[model samples]
Target: MARALQACLDGEVDEVTAQRVAVHGEGCRRCGVEITVYREIKNSLARQEVPDEAAMARLRAFGADLLTTGPAEAGDEAARLGGT
Candidate 1:
């Protein structure tokens, strides 16, 4: 049976298992593409830097307030939350 490909990608597999998957990927075009694509996506995400954690939290809180309170008090909440 094939080992879990996602496990390999996530580095959850041991070295021997990883080597096996790497070999399999080499012979199989589709598997190779999937591995390459996920690796690139993970690498790209690693390079990105989020600027403001606090602002994101505030926006999330504002969204939650909108859901519970609706538009009626949204303006006041937005004003208080510093949301435009």
Candidate 2:
């Protein structure tokens, strides 16, 4: 049942399966709650904004700095920060 709900939410189910789940949800309290929760989660995710190009560029540069740093230097920095 949970798998059916998840498959419906993920759009992996066929139209007939979706219709069956919708009908089942109407009669089943637990399925109704699951459907409502999934709907809210989907709505919230759809409302999220992506990072802009400048923010992405800065993040990439920061990642590059971390990658370019020598292992010994990283170990020294980690040790300074009380990390083993």
Model 2 Cα lDDT, one tens digit per residue, 1-84: 899899998899999999999999999999999999999998777765553667779989988888888676889999999996
Q: Which is the leading candidate under TM-score? A: 2
Total clashes for model 1: 0
Model 1 lDDT per residue over 1-84, tens place:
234778898899999999988898899988898888888998877765555677889999988988998976867888999877
TM-score of each: 0.54, 0.56
TM-score of 1: 0.54
True-structure RMSD, every candidate: 9.4, 8.9
How does model 2 score by TM-score? 0.56
> What lDDT would each prediction earn against the true structure?
0.83, 0.88
